[model samples]
Target chain A: MFAQSLVGAAAAVAAHLETLLAEHQALPVVEAMGYATRGGKALRGYLVLESARLHGVPEGHAIWPACAIEAVHAYSLVHDDLPCMDDDDLRRGLPTVHRKWDEATAVLAGDALQALGFELVSDPRCHPSGEVRADLALSLARAAGARGMVMGQALDMAAEATDVPLDLAQITALQAGKTGALIRWSAEAGARLAEVDPAPLTAYADRLGLAFQIADDILDVEGDAAMMGKAVGKDAGRGKATFVSLLGLDTAKLRARQLVDEACDALSPYADRAENLRAAARFVISRSN
Target chain B: MFAQSLVGAAAAVAAHLETLLAEHQALPVVEAMGYATRGGKALRGYLVLESARLHGVPEGHAIWPACAIEAVHAYSLVHDDLPCMDDDDLRRGLPTVHRKWDEATAVLAGDALQALGFELVSDPRCHPSGEVRADLALSLARAAGARGMVMGQALDMAAEATDVPLDLAQITALQAGKTGALIRWSAEAGARLAEVDPAPLTAYADRLGLAFQIADDILDVEGDAAMMGKAVGKDAGRGKATFVSLLGLDTAKLRARQLVDEACDALSPYADRAENLRAAARFVISRSN
Candidate 1:
């Protein structure tokens, strides 16, 4: 049921965003960007729509911010896969942006998409107050830029030293930056779009983001590349620091469950529309990819 | 006198933006960003102030946005110099951000500074309205992101083969991505912050950015490495396309003058405040570094 709901909500988001990102001006780039963006787990969007649902946010209100989140998330992936960055050539069973276009095009596409993400959040139709839109813009900017993703990547770059053996706290910080930061912000941004109190669920997102990372670590060990369309055991092969390495597989699996419970607990206060979000957290831990 | 004003204005920008950037939650990262940011020549800031002066914008009105523009420009340089990108270890006569802090920290600082630049623009303290600031933020975001500097870097990377003699238009587009686009937007954004007609002066900036590239091409042939603080003649050595290579040094110099003159002509309607901007056009050709 939760899996089906995630698909339903994500489809809703894609359907809504398709018109906004329709081909024009630089249509090829936009079309390429759309191709790169679709086929994500839609976990972040699910959390957003779920939170909106729990809070009784009117349908269609949260779509813009949800699309904005996905854009940023996808753009980050494109740049992150560059030869200089994560260097991955495959994502979600498709050629990475750099592989699809030249490296320059991928880099440019990612950069444009990042700016496009900010532009979307500030769309006059979605965010009424330029001030508030700017605020949201600021949030996405910081979360995706150096203070967040770039820093996490830098840490990942130097992680092979083994001296940087990350403890639980350090691991969590990286996760917060690498994956959780965006996820948490997606929910918060969606809530803020409706002018709702995000403080009520910010912690929920924190817990959920870490949960996502832990689950990812588990999947790397257990999943198949053909099925997952992502390199299996990449974390281990890279000698990168991960919770499973730091905590052992049993501990990491248990920790993921603990985080899932905390994430659900945080959402309990906003149970109405948040039901989807709550179920999404449970699904995060169990998904194959 | 113009040179003196430019230097003094840059110093002033460095001082004012310090306070704004200091308010970040991560102070070390913030200070490192400051280090990466503080040393700019303030040419872009001068354009903003001078452009505003052309329109008779009040002197006090220029400080915040002027500082903001410089901050944004500095942040772009900091990120651009990373090992994954330009890989330069030096900037503005000082060690680059990645050198000062670890790479991760450097990336974070750059990201934070970029976010901060937009945040400053959004606040009424810098510009008047959310509507205007949103546009301001959008303009900066579009020009600086992957499609702009990052894309340009990727192009440079792709062009690193033994030979790829680009035609004049391709060279222009490459330079536009690398050096021209941001400069063009810088002047436009400065005008936008002043709440004036940026279109007229943008022509000047377009010419100026192109002129700046032509001048850079000329310098590569004639410049001393000690003075340039960057590799000199590396373009030719690498067989990269450049104005000097495409049009020859003498023609490149002539094109630069024509561009500068055209830039000046674009500002004919408002001659008084355009003095520094005009001086900047001259500076682009004349500066040793």
Candidate 2:
């Protein structure tokens, strides 16, 4: 049931994005932006919609933040896949933006997409109240900015430059900023929109984000390249310390399961209304890709 | 007088940015961001502050938007000078971000700075009213996104791929979106802050933006490369059409002068109170570097 709901949410978000972006003049960067954002599982978008559903926020208002998170996610991927970063040629089973177009177009497309994310959340259409819009924009900016994803990326780069591999604690801190920050924001977005205290959602999201990263590490070890849509074993090859490397693969999997359970437990206050969110936590650990 | 005031504004904005960015972990990307934003003329920031002064908005409240625009401008320059973009090696008499740091650091730094810009404008410290913060974020995003700077950049790249050089009108449209968009936004910021009609400021900005581009074109033709801190003659060498090439040097200079006069005329509602703005208009045309 949760899987079906997630699929529907992803579809709705994609349609909204298409309509929103259709007005952009048919320039190459605009086209590249569309390409970059297309065909994701839209996990972040689903988190937003599910959390909103749990809070009784309508899909209409929730979709803006949903699309906004997805756009920011897409932009991060585009920049991360550039030659100077991950140097990945493939993403979502197709050429990355920098590979499909040129690096300049890739860079500009990513930059514009990031701007569009903020635009969507801050627009009056996103919410009737300006306070909500301001809150959403402010939180999204913090989650994606220096103290968040960018900081994680910088640390990752710095780790690559260093002779000593990162310890488990250091890697956790890096991942928290890089991937966890955005995940936390997506999970808490519904509560923000509904003007409810986000303590429960924040607690749920914090554990879920950690579980998600550990699952990623597990995927890097055991997943098929075709299913993952990119090369696996990159973490081991780069000699970067990941959860699997530090804790051992079996231990990493056990930790992820424990975190998933904790994440679900944190959502118990909402009872069955958060069933989808609970399922999402379990799915993170079990996902093949 | 305007030049001195601009210098002071730049310094103040720089100091504010330092305080905001100090919390960032000591990573290469953070360092590159600092380098990218340092020591510019801060024309956009000056516009924000000057326009705010004209509207009787306090400098304390106005400084946030001023710093925000400057941060966005710095991000654009960093990305524009990348090896895949203009491939310039110098900026503001210093090495470009990508040249000073690696391309990955440059890309992440630019992305972070853009986020910082939005974060600064949307933060409550910028204004107590959430409505004002939302409005500023929305407008800035639109002005800096695909419909604005990115659109201009994509057009520029596409024009390079074509056999035909862009005509005068086409180039003007391109530059208007590329450089003029931010200038217009900077000028209108004060009106937005004051919640006043921006017609006069908008009119003043439109003409001023055109004159500023024309002046840049003139600089490419005749300015000292060392003083400009970047290569000159690249436009002519690339066989790109510019104002000087299309209208001839003398005609281009005359057109810039006419635009400056009109920009000043648009500010007549404020009379002598807008003298600094008028001086800024003339300075755009006459500045050596």
Candidate 3:
């Protein structure tokens, strides 16, 4: 049931993004924008839709932010794959945007995607209350800007440049900003949309995000490239410090399971109504990709 | 009087941006963000502040959007100057961001600056009304997204790759998106903040933006590299289609003057209260850089 819901949310978000992209002029960058956004797991969008469902928010209103987060995620991936960054030629088993197009197109497409993300959330169609829309845009900017994802990316790059590997606490802080911030924002979005205190969801997301990263590290170590749809064992190859490297594979697995349990427990305030969210927590640790 | 106001607006916006950037972690990307934002004419920011003043909006509230537009402008310039793009080495008499830092830092800095733009406009402190803030963010996204500045940039790049030069109408349309969208947005922002119709200011900006581009073309043809603080005569050397190239230098100058007159005429609704704006339109054509 949870898997089906996740698939449904992905399809919905993809369709909505298609509609938005269709409204744009037929430029190559626009085409690249659409191309880059395709084939992601859409986990962030799923979190948004599921959390909104848990909060009784309508699918119509929630879909905008779902698409918004997906756009942001796609943009980060596109830029991350640039030759100057990760220098990856492939993502999700296909050529990255910079490989298919050029660096300029990739950069512009990524930029437009980020702008589109802001556009989707702040648009009046997303919510009737402008206050809610403004809050959403502001929070998203915080998640994506200098103090959040970008800072994490910079720190990661800096760490890679040095001979010294990062310690556990340093890695945790970096992961929290790089990936955790967006995940937390996605999970807590419904509460923000509903104008409720997001304390419980925040707690749930904090644990879920860490579990998600640990799972990613584990996948990098043990998962097959075909199953992951991208390069695997890259962290170990680069000698980059990750959960699996720092904690050992067995201990990392144990820690991820514990974190999943803690994440599920944080959803207790919603009782059985949050079973889907609980399933999502388990899925984070179990998924190969 | 116009020069003084423009300089004053630039200083105020710069100081506000400095305060905002000071709050972020001192990452290399964050430092690059500050470097990229400095030394511009701040024309778009000036338009925002002057328009807000015309609409009786306080400086405290207007400064956010002013800085927001500047950030967006800075991001575009940073990305445009990338090695894969315009490959510019100098801007405002100093090394470009990519020259000073690495390409990765430049890309991340530009991305963060764009996010900062949306954050500033949608911030609660920017306005008292949520509706207005949301509107500002939505409009800014439109101006900066695929349909606006990015489209213009893509078209410009496409034009460069082909042997065929764009026709007058095609070039006009391209420039309208490239530089005109943000200028129109800046000019119309005060009315949006005041919750009034932006038709008059939009009219003024359309003409002013066109005139500004023609003047830029003229500068490229006849400018001193030392005074321009960047390359000159490159458009002619590349045989690119431009206002001066298509219309001839004398005709381009004449057209710019006529557009300035039309832009000034559009502000008749404000009568003598719009003297500063009239001065701005003239300055757009008269300035050397």
Best by lDDT: 3
DockQ of each: 0.29, 0.77, 0.76
Please provide, for model 1 over B1-289, each residue's C-alpha lDDT reduced to its tens digit, 9 standing for 90 to 100. Answer: 8989888888777877777655544445666877876766888777767766665555466666577667767766766676755678766667787787766466446555665666555555555432434666666666765456544554565566436577898678777877876787767765676667788788999999999988888887898777776667777776778888888777888889999989988877675657778888888888623
What would the per-residue lDDT of candidate 1 be over residues A133-249, giving only the tens digit for each residue?
A: 465666776677556765565455555445666777777776787787788788786567667789757888888888888888888888788887866898888777778888888
lDDT of 2 by residue, A1-289 (tens): 9889888988999999999899999988999988988899899999998888877888888899899999999999999999999999989989999899989899999999999999888876666353535788889999999899999999999999988999988999999999999999999998988889999999999899999999999999898789988878999888889999999988998999999999999998998889999998899898733
Lowest lDDT 10-mer window, candidate 1 chain A? A124-133
**TM for chain B in all models?**
0.90, 0.97, 0.98
| Model 1: per-residue Cα lDDT at residue A69 | 79
Tens-place lDDT per residue, model 2, B33-110, is 888889988889989989999999888888999999999999999999999999999898888898888899899999
Comparing 1 with 2 on TM-score, the higher-scoring candidate is 2
Instruction: Note the residue pairs that clash in candidate 1.
Output: A53-A273, A54-A272, A54-A273, A54-A274, A111-B146, A146-B108
Model 3 stretches astray by more than 4 angstroms: A128-132, B128-132
Query: Model 1: share of native contacts present?
Result: 0.27
Candidate structures ordered by DockQ, highest first: 2, 3, 1
The collision pairs in model 2 are none
lDDT of each: 0.70, 0.89, 0.91
Backbone clash pairs in model 2 (N, Cα, C under 3 Å; residues 3+ apart or in different chains), count: 0
